[model samples]
Target: MKKIPVLFILVLLLAFWGCSQKEKKVSVKKVGPIDPQMVQDQDDMTWEDYKPIPEISWADPSIKPKRGFKMALVAVDFPDQPFVITQPKGSDLFGNPQIDPIKREDVAQFYRDFFIKPSDVNHGQTINGYWMEQSRGEFGITEVDAYGPYQLPKNLWEYGLNEWGQNDFTPDGSKPKGRMERDVDSLWRAEYGDLRKNYDAILRIYASYDETGVWQEFGEMKFNSKEDIPPEWGNPNPDKPRWVATRYVPWTSWKAGAMQWGISSIRQGENSGTITHELGHYAFRIGDNNNNPYVEPYRRAGSGPWDMMDRGCFNGPGGPHKRWVVPAIAGASMPAGLMVRNRMKNDFLTEDDILRLSRDSLAVTGLAVANITARAVEPFEGEYAGVIVELDGEEPHDRTPVDDPAENPLSPGIPNYDYYSLEVVQRIGYDSYCPDNGVLLAKNRDKESRNGGVNQFNCFNWVIDAHPEDINMVDYDKPNGEKVMRTIADYRQLNDALFHAGLNSGSEFEYDDPYNRLHFYIIDLHRNQEGILSYTIGVKSLDGSGAAKRDFQLTAPKTTKESVALFTLKNKDKKAGLDASCFDNDIYRLAVSTEGEGLKAEILNELAVVSSGEEISIPVYFSEEDGEKSDVRITLTAVSESDPSKKMEASYVIP
Candidate 1:
């Protein structure tokens, strides 16, 4: 049976049969850009010049064998190279370096073949190509049309966070067309990396998208004429060709594409990965995991370097080349976001390898998988918790975060800039629901918080979706500009907690006060005096100070007896007890998950749980994390069947 492709990914988002949200508590930690050496550079120099571009062999095929996807990327003149090279020597190599008069015709022929060979429409697989065609994963010619804002010039090869002032490009004007910035940090170069040469150009962005929603880039090919680029583009100090791929792709839209499809001799030098990368996407909706914020078809891995999904990022592979691969959806396959946990435990894997491989694998998982995700967070501690809570009927587990699917849709068109959360996750610590690397492939988007509230545990990122298994609650902070009772939370223990606390019998339980009066236990009040847990008793209430009243409200303190001292309000106010007049005159105690943080209910126009509730219900909400996945310190701020605020907070480790 054949499964038809859906209309669009976002469309499915709106109509998901059962949507749930899993969140990660990620702290926003800033990181500088990666150095130029960290980025991969692909040069398909022609044999006429150095050795002609080498052919990448993917012909062996797996499973379906010949029936599998077939693609080839033929660079017109081997411009941008994804490999390491020494600075250019003073060969002063010059000669109207191979210019095709009918470049337009050549380009046209290239596409003709690209569409004709396997018939482009999904040879027998998905229609409209990969994401199925975002990065397409074909080693074909590419340009700004597909790369959109992420395109880099064959002449301007380096990548990282980019966005340079025009001045950075050729302050000297030696290369009038344009110049690549050399002094910028690795990040700036990637985000705003600009064009280097003046000739026609084509850049192939290798991409991979797993079941999660992250697009990973593993390779790229930028082609242009060195001659077209001014001397400045090459760098006055000159280190290997700044743009190894400046072969023949001009800034113009010509026919050089014909050679890219393996038809023209002038195009023999094209980077095969360039074409192959696009095909990879078409075949799998896989993105480039390059980890270079500026480049596209970016592929990222959380661990293991044996698959094409593990191509770019920390898994540099020494030089440019995305040669290995694993079945993205094998029965025993791990979620791409968390492939690293296994790698890290294996003797063959090193910390450095884990860093690179995991990032790459996660990036792939983040891009492709609709259910899981991984974050490449900076190393942090305690701030993160790994726990699974039941949601939509799922059971709880001890695993950490899956990738944040809400923010990571992995399809093309969405810029890598939106990926800041990945950086934030990488900064804290890496974990995975599936353990592809240490990251999780997440689902369940937290969409309601955007309207605004004092939600401390809710996620701030509007884009990412969390997992359904981790029950992270909605949170908000107090508004009254005051701190009541100090509280402590135990978010990490959610998975192990049974959350079985509730009323023992019915409404009438015997109780005696110091007055020796046997009174019926009508209402349950919390320690801090924030709220009252009234029983569903016939309307009857009499108020008095201290232990005299059962339905109204009162004051108290101390709600913890944990082996480890739980919490103390750094700022405590003796005057912070509950104001009974604020709670609903009628109602029973509220039951919530152990992951429950805080609560507040108001009467007519008056509000007892205003911004800062009476010390009774200690503040329940906090700040939402800006990034996707993270730890949520949810404080149980409510009137339990047995207690009230008294600063009773239970931490919930959420998305």
Candidate 2:
């Protein structure tokens, strides 16, 4: 072989090394705001198609008020359990009686204003305010009058120590005293004869703790076990154990476990009670959306902390565990706002406020896309407060598999659901204490009673959990040093159920139910200048593609950072070609792969929503934890959400 110059060989090696070391310049295009007008209008679709899901009517129409109404507030005190307001500061286990003793009239006025008027004590939150805001001023308490702090005939324990096992521990070992309503009502009638008929609703505020608030706090939470409960916390009968059987859990402190949890039938409440939740029962005739959260045969919560009817009533500064605090300033203080289902059930939402679609019609129309404003506020003109996709065509609309909750608490339960409701929940207004903000999607039954069967759990609204895996949160530490994990039935389990748009957003953007033949997508999120959240959502039948074409073009990838590459995916559908009457946006599912040893790649967002002529920038990150860094190739794949067959791929080499 002819001899080659050593210098020439050296130069060749140097040039090759330089070429391998060269950096690729990446240009990131700024994605603009999605135009609200781009979303298709379903004007051609009428409400008649929504016949499958009929309008919700109150069980008792007489109580459904559409205008301002009068409310009466009556205060009562027990000989044994004086009003917490009359006790010294820090008198109870929860450091209750946060204030010094006050006159009975002052206490009555405090509660009256707390329920009817906005005051600094209630943080400007009131039952009337909640109703007015929830009803959009369609209804509220026009007038509120406070009555006497009439003393009850029986001792507080007579009424409080009745439920659970307290009956066996009564002073004489007889059934705990009953007829709290009859006693209080008689007292009120004698003092203000027939005045009860003047008010639209009557609220009886009693002194002492609401069992729901103190049950766990003074029971299992304070003691290691039933056997460990001390005499001080026991019933009046010293021979009887202090612990007693209670709902959901096996045992709790007798003092609290058996106390009557604020009742709504008689509109009775306590100092540390969720009056809003009770009002939901008394005023709207809505049943509890909560599920059994403490015992075996674990079942998931219904709406969880996202709806006031559920454990969302326990929303506040300290979560459910801190509900024992008095002055009602901690947990259960600020309840979550009503969800779309409850709002509709209570006649709060208008006909035009919701975009209704029939599941059967979706198969013919392809897909429906619209923007929904947050449930906390009124929607803008041409916008909807929510989207309802009714399961229309078949005899069995919900095709979800019947799974045993006892085996897996996360099971979807009996599948006799009637429709799906999609709404946005933002941490604003009454929802300020809600855990998160995103798309709230749920499978709902038209009739609340239909939620019972295999699981025997009653739930009318079943929220779809985006992250179903156990969150592994510790509820509280037992006195014996054991860690009690929050059960699958715990309402907080749904804390991460809301779906958010884009990849790596810690939530899924879309939910696909092949059995139900539906695909729901949270395409993009937007916040107006007022800090209100809204989402551009799309729904399509898995059986067919919508009227809009699903096509996109992915640009060549470029690296802005050593291990980061950016790609712009643009919708190929021509805006001019779209039918003005019914157009649909396109959703793209992205995937990233790496071709090199010890190299790993990830895409910032696994999904993107691109409208006609619109584009989105996707970021891919590369990492090499081991082995020497070398040239690596990254492939980016984009698949159309509406039409999986339509796909595109691009690649970039990082040195």
Candidate 3:
């Protein structure tokens, strides 16, 4: 009797299990960008055909010539104290000299060899690849001495601290940051002003100071204590981490004067990569590609290891921090290269270099393919013109920055904005620092706006990111499981997150415009043996009228049924002519199959002509004589006549 009850209990448990299986998550087709005009209907769905555009007549302004661009290398120091090249040994309280006190010519020779000499490792490419390519070998950079060691009018921190009140040194007070530029200029004029016109730009280099000396100088200033010094001044180690002054970017309209360039002061015997970064600003009129390190959520990445304009300048064998060691080949390790957007802006690439296609055009054409090369290397004629797939639509405009603390505010112009951009990113050349290899799609507003609180020219350029929540991808300082506040360590993580296309075939990226007039899709991604990345993309237009299109989607079954499996088919087209009998060349063929015995497949509408507002049902039945214990598997495929490879599928199991 107990065994009979146990058997009944087992049957009851099995019945409950069968019912629970019906609630499983339905599998939907993952497709790239979807058109907004298409909607799910009872029996059918409308889909648009997407293909690459042949070409776009890009009209970027021609790059200004930088030929004969001479830069003066001035070795300046404080009064009476001669500049000494001090190399630090591990944990040493004081720095030890690597060589005898060097003169201005030594510094000049160091830069000449660093920039002009071809690197054996990087295919004989010179460190000055960015400038050389833009100048086409016509540019000349001259290095000169600023005579004797130029003396500062006051202590290094004093000139700048005086600009801020005692309270301003506090955490919440305004951090008068740019005042150092004034001190740099004042010292320059007192010493090198007479020789100013001798070069197109002036680079002032300084030696690193010991931590004790730095803290002492800060203490002497009216500022409270060492606490008031910029966090960049904090010694990395108590002993001798070496006191490399922060790299000040080049500014044309600096308080000191125009055409003034400054580099991050390095360890006495070390060289500099900051020069190349500053040059990007001075020579090209381009803004810094890096995020403001002093801002909040400190790990946010700016461009992440991709473009010369971003963190790629820090690319090398180890990383940016590793360059601090002496006998270092690390400083100029992976000298960065330009990205497509920067290339286009600099006029380094012409319209002939890019292929521009419209969403409407792709819908008319069936399918297209592109064999693209890495953007870092020179293009091979037409491997891929910077891919510009356009979704013809518009959305309401609101340009207010999310965080801007400026006193005077600017209006975000444009009642409505049209047009956007997409580009590919691969790990090649300087871009070896990039985190992944895939398509980098972004929203590029056709208008320009200053990055509000950041006060940068390139603020308008925004990259859509796939992982905004992950801070480790682009940040240097880690939070280490502590409450995040607006401390220097926390704020500097502000970065511009960029969205990438799906990493593989099973994944897809779909983006609909804010106004719902268009769709952008990253159909597929592939990487070749040469380490080049190629992206397949589709853009769909949602405007009222263009061409009639059909999209197919299978609504996967949730649970097991007795012997019959049922599926829903939807048509999303808006054309008026779509109806049940429209199948001549635009018919959808349904194919059904099953894995288990006794399960017979039957399609109610094998070659159904699904209209825009129609819906169809498909059922696969199993014979009762096959037995109740058999588990059946079923699949339904919908193929369109427009494109044979373009299909959608749904699967289910019957127990």
Candidate 4:
């Protein structure tokens, strides 16, 4: 080879050395500390400043279909194969289950007569309710289940679907139903004292509750299944188990009744009364008809703690179908037909239902209504690096809301905060909001920082370092500064549950709620991605029934002042802080409605204001109406200059 020129040779050597020194980039998911590119203050800041210009926008989606009514069919195909339907040898106090084994024909007709057919105007009786005729569900039921012998599955008891033994419980580990199928008729026999009583009460008060002129909401609540779920462990055919119960098709989607019609081991028990529970799903799609311990919201679950819809209510006397006060049972009342119907269909408050449940959506801040309100919040982005939760915080204890804004200081946005009987230093503590606020609350105790950039409070998650007893106390071994982190093992079980439902991702995942966390009724922490990640605290299905701690976050609330013709929000100081409106502070609880794809998304960010990294829950809300268009993504930028055009920016949206 020809000898290289001295200058060229030196250049080649230098180039080779530079290439050798370069290293390959390894990917890491950990979002690093604020990128310098995120910094806009190239020069130190003066106290006074104006915001940088932003692309102005705001829009809202109108005609977003109001909750509409829909239905799905779930007929109980009680054993398509032949089975000997029997009954218990005796009767109960109700005289309901003394006989058995009529023909499948009689069993099928009974349900159709009770739930599917028109009540013939009850002739002479004053029949009322939605006679104005709101569309009742289109009724249909599968043919009677194919008759078959009581073929017990080898592991029926182990699975607990069959209530043969006392140990047989719910799918999520609750006590098993104790109703024995007695007086075996051609179909089956078993007394449903409380369950039937509830059905009669519903029939007794149908018109008074819904004088809308519409017929029975569900003219037909059908059931379809093998009419039996063999216990995985103990006895083969355990009484008459309701196979198809109330359930929602998608999240709040077309809800319908389900049941296992005829085909049972007990006598006189096989009738449509059992099917009434499932028919509730169709009639109201708001809750189940029967307080089936096997269902999700069995007979005692509510954000208010317990109700007649939570699982394991058989333990409570008067549960398992038994009405409490002989008049109505449970508390001072029973659930009204309007309760589930209005709440689910129109997001309306059902006075009668609230009255029956001994609760009032119009009197107190009913949790169901509150949940509906809280769900209105929009998210910051598609997914998030982590979640922020606030379970309990500094609010006066014994807070009694009186529906009217005049009685309660917090409602109607007067003070926008409620009065509490707590210490002065303990008002609006961290547990009352999403945990993201806690990250900032850690510094609230600092006497030097009362108004360190954060002036007013929005949610409980904004305050941190509050072992104030006023805030929820959680067990934590160690913390990684932003969020607590110790054993990834402890969280694995939750991770697995979410994963199985296609809710979350990452094999070595980690998350913690040190404070049990606030649930803003966004119900699920779900995403529509491949891993189908979400957060679940055992509310096994999409139908509403359970508490979830994952749907919380501090939002950047709204304000009257907005940047004119610019895509930016103003700061309370009357001065501009992220000139480009980088720190818009507007945020919300993300929830996906059934009418739309699970377009709901969420993202949380902790900004280190100026130099101090204090936590704060800023308020922010957005709608297509809030911006010029729905496609406009809200961006947050930080800059020292009055103009943001010359600064770096980062953004998150409710995509």
Return the top candidate by lDDT.
2
The TM-scores, one per candidate, come to 0.22, 0.83, 0.54, 0.21
Model 1, 195-271: lDDT tens per residue?
32321323332111111111111111211333343443344334332222212111211111111221111111212
What lDDT does the true structure give each of the candidates? 0.21, 0.72, 0.41, 0.20
The weakest ten consecutive residues by lDDT in model 4 span 420-429
Cα lDDT of model 3 by residue, 1-655, tens digit? 0111111233344345546656542211122221111111111111111111113101111322345456555444444223444322332222323333445446544434444454432223333444544333333343333333445453333322232132122222333345344455566567546556666666655433322122212221212322343433333233422222222211101111111122333112233454566666676666654554433323233344555665566555444443332223342345445655666676667676666655445444422234344465444433563555544422233322344334322212222223345666554444444444455554444434444343343443344454443343332222233332322221112122333342222223555654534555554444443434555454444442234565666687675343345576776654534221212123355687777764555543344334455665554433433344366577888875444565888888765
lDDT of 2 by residue, 1-655 (tens): 1223222233344344435555632212222222111111111212121111012211112234468678778889887777777777887645777666777768778787766665556555666666766777667767778887889888877776676655665666667656587787788899779887788777777887777777787888889878887777887688777777776577888777656778785444455558878778887888887777876778788998888898888877677877776677667776778888889998999778988888887776666788888787788666799999998886788888777666877775778888899998876666767777788999888877635544456678889888888767888888888998888788888888898876556678789999889989877776665456677788888887656556789986544444455678998863434453334567777888877665677754465776677786666655554676666778899998777899999988766
| lDDT value, residue 383 of candidate 2 | 71
Candidate number of the best TM-score: 2
Candidate 4: residue 326 lDDT (0-100): 15
Better of 2 and 3 by lDDT: 2
